[model samples]
Target: MSDPVRPGAVRAATLTRQPAFWVVAALLAAGAVRIAQITGRFLGVYPLATVTAMLLFALLAVPFWLFLSELDFLEREPASLRILAFAWGGLVATSVSIPGSNSLENLIAKLGSPNLAADWGAALAGPTVEEIAKTLGVVAIVLIARPQVNSVLDGVVYGALVGLGFQIVEDVVFAVGAVAQAGQGDQIQPVITTFLVRGFLAGVWSHTLFGALAGAGIGYLVVNPDRTRAHRLAMAGLALFGAWASHVLWNSPLFREGLGDGAVALLAVLVFKGLPPLLLILYLVRRAHDSEAAYYVAKLADLRDPVLITDGELRVLGSGTRRAAARRHAAARAGRRGRAAVRRLQRAQARLAVELSRDADPDLRHSAEVQRQRTALTELGHPEAVEGDPSWRHTVSTVGTTVVAVAVLWAALSFLGNG
Candidate 1:
């Protein structure tokens, strides 16, 4: 599942010949230095706050990293390329956005009225500069490692990572700023408050979401080699616009005045601004995943080998939900070992499918891996890892979880309102 240099990874030989490699390397180095300087100054002034913010945001990044990495698990984006995308987002985009946003903001102030700039400048300026910078991170991937980004999901993975990188770094800066503005010397209270508000509340619909929206566009442009140049470019522009518009809506002051300062109002504002993009990204991810699944699953189906993968297993492999269900189905028969065996079988089958798609002849090592997992599943007493009859337990668990989440959210909002 994790390879240092997977099939789609750019090789040293390839990098040596590509000018874009050297260019990106240089820019990343410069951006890293810029960010270090800014962060260093913050640390010098507010040692406690800066370190706390860094730790908090760094911790926050873990789940996002896992989600995006698994987003395109079948033909997974190379880890090296993924790291590059994150580096670009954290160092390049954040560094550029810091000053680029300010310059654009001043322009907005001069061109429009001060009141207009004060109100709408962030909506306009931040999205325009930041999105461009982040989307360029995707483009840089195309320039340097085109192989890893063969699918639309590949673009989303890279784009979201770039956004995640930028989001974490930007959030850290903002958190420390919040502490400084609290007028309390190097306190963790403001940092914690910012974590709850910005990291917890706004995070789902923040930079990563915008990056995915835009990345979907870039992915469409790159992957659709069949489409006309004009059409591809137009779609990419449309996608970028969607990302920028989403950012604008999130940052705009239009909703703030209408919604009062209460926590419920804040919750409503978050839902109004965030839910649309969240749904959009979900739709895009599902579509991209289905397309990729169909491509790889078809290859496995062509094998027509029961020992390697049966029709039922292929069906399970074709869907993320069914794949999870298969594991649960296995767990019901045996236990944790059954679940683990099912997961391994799925991964092996996926790897074999990917190999079959790329190479006309199946890779022996991958095929052997699939058979090995199948053998383990047999030993676990759940031979076929296909999903069984739908369970009432799953339904009850889902409903119960949903209820608890809603109740907790209501409680938090009520407490905030009271405060």
Candidate 2:
């Protein structure tokens, strides 16, 4: 009663407090700089070529985005945040890192043996600069919206998005560079070669994997409130080190040792060099997903409300294929309306699970959102029960088949291209 807050002061406070505002500002600034750089670099020289490369790589990025997006089934990040992460990776991180890395490489060459620098510059400077730059995007997202990355899986999703942006942009850059280097008036071949090697063969275990590893540490630091600060710092450091080590290994010349100059040798190089890290990251991602799913499922175990989420629904939600089958079944039963309602129900249930985990509250029926979604589901004629998730064996088999198919496709493309 003694003091009334001024309207201006209130508005200022609100603006300063909003993480979303800062995020938007960062994206705009970074995006402007990036657009300027791209225009300056390519507009005068290879305008159409650059555009074509960007468009092609962007189209390639879609499948990767979809694949990584599915990993965060419980709580997807907001579109605004996702866009911010991508922009930071593509615009901010790449913008700064390119010049910084080149300078570092030049410095190393001047100070030391140029031949040694030429051979190991990437292994040394690339990992240090690139990992930090990409990881910074994840850190920025966490700083702007602490709640967006509530689990390791959430971190991985955002990290992957950031890396995806960086990957696409970098691929385009490499393709353009290849075109210029060839100087043979045939840009298509160079572009295709770059895309085949970078976009297809090395896409899986590249910057995206490094960013995810680092982001997992950052997320663990932000989410686990009870952990001691020292422990959190250690986790953060360990993650960065892991990312740096992985990047170093990838860029190192060790893989070139015994590599021959044939298609089979190239395949062997990819498999031997890329497979171990790919397998390691896959294991880490799966474990992170399992931990998050278990946490949310445990929170919802006692809940039995059909409107909110049933145990059967919980099982289906954790598995991607089951979720798809459930939606298909609903569509088959009551047409598109049923499918839409089921989606709504699933989204609401996911949101509620997130809220429950945050508050550590099992009794979520009293939440307004819970009641509203429940009413919506009932009004739409609650979708039929979903079949349970497949056994671990089936899931593994499906995943393995998908991986094999992708590898075979890449090999076929390479074989055809050489032919």
Candidate 3:
């Protein structure tokens, strides 16, 4: 009996050790492979060229990802679902739409005249089909992951990611095509420059922006499902109209003529055309963020804790300085544990705050109340302190509005100057 028991215990210990060994081995293998690939790719090329391009892509993509992630706080959805939204845009949507549009254009050309086909391709094919296709990605996201999309901002962010993905892939193909067409002795500098300008700057307003605008309408429709059919139809119409208008203005020959004259035309398009819609979207996002903050603050009022969250504390929650101070205070008291708790509370508070801002159903209100109480118990000790004042809410709203307005104004002016 003793011999059998001893062997069993040893076997169990070995099994546990095996998993740990394998995990470490796998990680080491992955790292080694990555290093080898990087070294081999850069061996003959310019020392820092590949590295520089990667860094540039990271710089551009990371901010866009962060912006979308932040807006996600308002909706309270899973990251996986959000990514799925982007994947659908890039994969299924792009694949089907591109081929379908090409087929249709070819058919039209054969039936009519080649010049007529070219005219239709320029005016209708690019704007109508591409916008519809990209916007469908946003719609699919809303359909499949309804909970993830709460506002127009969410639509914009997701739509933008999809568009960005499409644009990046398309640009790569264009660059390679240019190189191939130019034949053996041609310099690739012109192709590279074209990729930078068209893929980076103009990409911002391309398919992604249009999809976002349309997505906002879709999100609004879904959010307000109780509306009359006529109202929903009207909103849908508006969304599609907004998307097509943006696409048309972006692809139109008027702007193309300006590019030849100087940077002025490009500047005009960016400022007068691009800045206004972007500003409008930002304004809407600010409102959503403020509303979310107010909801959580209100929920805390019911907790009755001792670490009284004053109107001032609520104000601090809205401002970066105040949040930092809270983190410092918590960290000082509890060290690492306290800091972690503070961060968790901050996120919880933000979520509950957003929930409270909306006139929630009874079930939602009750759920939020319970969560608020629990969070208060964990962080502030039981009976969490709560102070009431509507003015604090106003202050937060005012600050957010002012900040967004200033940003829009600055961008608009910069665009105008460039034009």
Winning model by TM-score: 1
Per-residue accuracy of model 2 over 32-135 as CA lDDT, tens digit each: 68757775787568776777777788888888887877677766767667777777777777777778889888888988879978889988888888888888
Which structure is stronger by TM-score: 2 or 3? 2
Model 1 agreement with the true structure over 131-170: per-residue lDDT tens digits: 9999999999888787777778888889999999999999
Error of 1 at 159 (Å): 0.7
> What TM-score fits each model?
0.95, 0.82, 0.62
What value does the lDDT take at residue 228 in candidate 1?
90
Model 3: per-residue Cα lDDT over 287-373, one tens digit each: 545654444555556545334344555665654445655555555454566555655555655555444444443245445554554
Considering every candidate listed, which one attains the maximal lDDT? 1
- What order do you get sorting by lDDT, best first? 1, 2, 3
The C-alpha local distance difference test score for the whole of candidate 3 amounts to: 0.55
Q: So what's the TM-score on candidate 1?
A: 0.95
Give stretches of model 1 more than 4 Å off: 1-9, 411-419
Provide the overall lDDT of each model, using Cα atoms, as 2-decimal numbers.
0.88, 0.72, 0.55
